[model samples]
Target: MCTVCGCGTSHDHDHGHDHAHGHSHGELHFGHGPAGAQVAGMSQARLIEIETDILSKNDRFAAANRQVLQARGAFAVNLVSSPGSGKTTLLCKTIEALGDQPLAVIEGDQQTANDAERIRATGAQAVQINTGKGCHLDAHMVGHAMEHLDIAPGSVLFIENVGNLVCPAGFDLGEDCKVAVLSVTEGEDKPLKYPDMFTVSKLALLNKTDLAPHCDVDLDLYEANLRRVNPGIEVLRLSARTGEGMREWIAWLRGNLGRKVPQAAE
Candidate 1:
């Protein structure tokens, strides 16, 4: 039982054969302790302590990962959003458009290796992190991933976090910035409803603009809501499938990538 976060902990550390975060997840049972005695006996102070400890542990891991990347002068971006927000497609397009500049990806999901496979298809080395029953990717998991991947100096590492809005918002994975991908098809009120995500995000990608005309999506209302939640958040109207607004995304990536800029030819 994890006194911190109450999410429990696994110290098996099975990293020999599997991918990053080789955790032996424990089965979750409802009600705290035997016959729910612990839940009834637990004080509010204990719960607060747990939360603080959990976050602090995660932050320690995040800090170490940040130091490593900064030392190498590499850029790390965490891409987060709800499921089916075209994040994978956007990454594929970004990788292809960037054109071979030492790019690697860490794909996080609960199940299959499909997303990582899709990313590798675009001509970049990629690895998948399967977080079974886990809604968010924490810093510890990402740190493990960095050990296996070749994220060298002046390279770009994109960590595609698990599809989640609430949990991922609070967890810091040692990223330089969080890029929120919100699809127009998801609805205009998402930003207002999930304000925490927008607040944490440095940039919001208004994806699927190609389908905006077909759907009754209000771009203005979305803009207002997003700005209300994150006053200074940069936004780009884009469509990953159609090759629209991709140049701007590349420019953003280049500006954030290390000291030496990537050559136009490669």
Candidate 2:
């Protein structure tokens, strides 16, 4: 039987039907024949085609979202981090630092609106996308949230991706840059182990620096390893819990924003 579709017949043969009987009678071979083989093959091809079509559609939607954001002169940042890496906390601090600036956030998670609630507490317009069973947020989901968000022209939009270091790196969310967050407690060798995540990120946020004294992570060595993989990538070491080293992080963000809008300060 086909376990996937449950449409094919069982291939079990009766022990009672001896081999001697099968020589003359074809009842022993009681499974789908040539016609069924052809049907199964066609079904598999159709499935492959469907998967290809779905990914292509998603890529198109992502490109469209990028164009829309560029036309509006908005900068979108996609935040990727592991669970409990303080991604939401950093976002709250970012919103606070930007004070009175036009900023919106899209929070992605497998369940619960907890992160979105946190962002809202910081006074930023936030939309939560519960991906259900999806491991990562795709561009389609982000685009849908954009419709509900009151994003102004030239505003900053931060997308807090589902807390994951692996799967999220493979998907593009039409963001201007990707920020990868890694806490000191997670170990210094993470960049070497998960090279793809480090490679794709424009900036690496090394969170929980206040706990560096307690952990055995070598900050200098970690930064060296990261630069080896991604030369010229900006790394910010900060602790959201203690608010240490946040100024540098915020300054870098503001500088990037300034480059986009020269009259931003005025």
Candidate 3:
């Protein structure tokens, strides 16, 4: 099974040769030596072709979802981070900062709806998608949930992707931008370790600055690593718990939403 996408099938194979080798059915067979050895090279090639097809299909769906969101004038933001990285807390702060503006949240988790409940407490419309054992939320799931939301045409929709750095980066949730959340407690080298997450993200939120005084996290090193992977990516240092640097975060969000909503027609 593939650990990244959680989409792989286990199969038993029989090798007619002295050396044990496994091959999937419908694969090419290369005749081995003068001993009539059965070649199973085609099976491996088939597997690669199937994997490519699956990813291409998924990419198509993601593009369609993006079009739908854009047509509705929705500013969708995908939040990604490790578990306990304070995604919900930052979302709550964002909701509060939006004030009377129309905002909706789509919370993704492995099991419980606890994060969605917390988001709803902030008076924003919140929907939770429990992915069960799945590590990431794909475009289809987000597109489906969008229909059930009460978001207005020009609303801001925040999709808090499952708390994971790897799989989520591989799956696009049809969002206008992906915002990666890395708490100070998670250390500064996270960007270096998870280069794909940082590279694809349009913005990086370095949360828990309030605890910086107590933790050994080096802010400079963290920012340096993120820049190394994506020099153009915006980085924000904030503490959701203490509300530090929240205004700037809110301002950034408002600016994005404002651009999408358009100015008053004279």
Task: Single out the weakest 10-residue window by summed lDDT for candidate 1.
Answer: 12-21
Candidate 1: list runs displaced more than 4 Å.
Answer: 1-5, 9-44, 258-266
221 in model 3: Cα distance from truth in Å? Answer: 1.0
Candidate order (lDDT): 1, 3, 2
Q: TM-scores for all candidates?
A: 0.83, 0.77, 0.82
Better of 2 and 3 by TM-score: 3
Cα deviation at 114, candidate 1, in Å, is 0.6
lDDT of 1 by residue, 14-35 (tens): 2222112223586443334222
Kindly report the root-mean-square deviation of model 3 from the true structure over all alpha carbons. Answer: 8.1
lDDT over C-alpha atoms for residue 42 of model 3: 29
Q: Model 2: which residue pairs collide?
A: none
Q: Give the Cα-based TM-score of candidate 1 against the true structure.
A: 0.83
In order, candidate lDDTs are: 0.82, 0.77, 0.79
Model 3, 2-28: lDDT tens digits are 222125434334443333444788554
Residue lDDT tens for model 2, 132-211: 86777888899999999987777888999998886677677888889999988888788887787889999999998898
